[model samples]
Target: MAVTRWIAVAASVLSLGTLFVAPPDAPMKKTDAFLDAETTGVLGIEATECFDDPAYSRMANDRVVIYRPCEESADNQAFGFVYAPDGAFDRPAVAALGWDRCGAAFGKLWRGGSAEGLDFYPVLPTAETWADGDRALMCVVYRPGGKLPGSVLPLAN
Candidate 1:
């Protein structure tokens, strides 16, 4: 789906689920780290450390992990999650589900009026990764031509 359309759908579904932002002291999951590493490799962005701003702690669901780069100059925030399906695994189906899930959650924050200028998109599991049983999807949020100052969670508050 187009980014704008997905955002619209996501805004409608924001209130559908409970949202949780990971506490600063919480341990980072290996999956979260893996997503971070993979994203760096895939996007070719140089990030030496995790973003640790107290105001912008990581966010997670039971399966998804959203992270950001530490560099104050970075342009976007990223979310990674395993997209396992109950039945046969189809690429399009998996992508759609992952996309919507990210959209809904992020949409919640955006609809709350906290995420005014940011945009988001998902990077889905490639065929090679899927063959190896990796179903991770990374959702990235960003503001065009700008840097984020803090967490969207708090902005909503």
Candidate 2:
């Protein structure tokens, strides 16, 4: 399935509140490092670090996103955050919004250079979190193959 379709389907499923059940231990705290990560900090995520699958998956599930410094490899490299408009958690819509935002940011970052091997994706919020007032969309840039060695941001010549 296309990424947008998959995101829509996942959003629909999560809206139903059924796939993942919270563990019976302590209630998850919002202050967890992942949950409390600021946009500035997230923007620093690069080839130096990456988000594991569990963390990347949680991005759409309204859960804290765990990240680790890239040792040998990683799933995705976070590069920035997009401020999604305040509204219901509509995955496809938010994804589009995020893409638009990321596109502009990417243009500024790359100065119109070709992003031939790189692609951008958004980590959007779940309906529950939307209702509870989460409006940030994490944006990431990654190569199709796998892990990167250093920051993806283009440097001045």
Query: Per-candidate TM vs. native?
Result: 0.49, 0.54
Return the number of clashes found in candidate 1. Answer: 0
Judging by lDDT against the true structure, name the best candidate.
2
Give the alpha carbon lDDT tens digit for every residue of 81-115 in model 1. Answer: 43566555676787677668877867765675566
For model 2 the local lDDT of residue 110 reads 59
What value of lDDT does candidate 2 attain over all alpha carbons? 0.59
Q: Return the top candidate by TM-score.
A: 2
Q: Give the lDDT of residue 131 in candidate 1.
A: 70
- In candidate 2, position 31 carries an lDDT of 13
- Residues 35-118, candidate 2, lDDT per residue (tens digit)? 223332343344335765444344455443356565545555666777777656676787678778877876776565467566
- Cα lDDT for residue 41, candidate 1: 44
List the pairs of residues colliding in candidate 2.
Answer: none
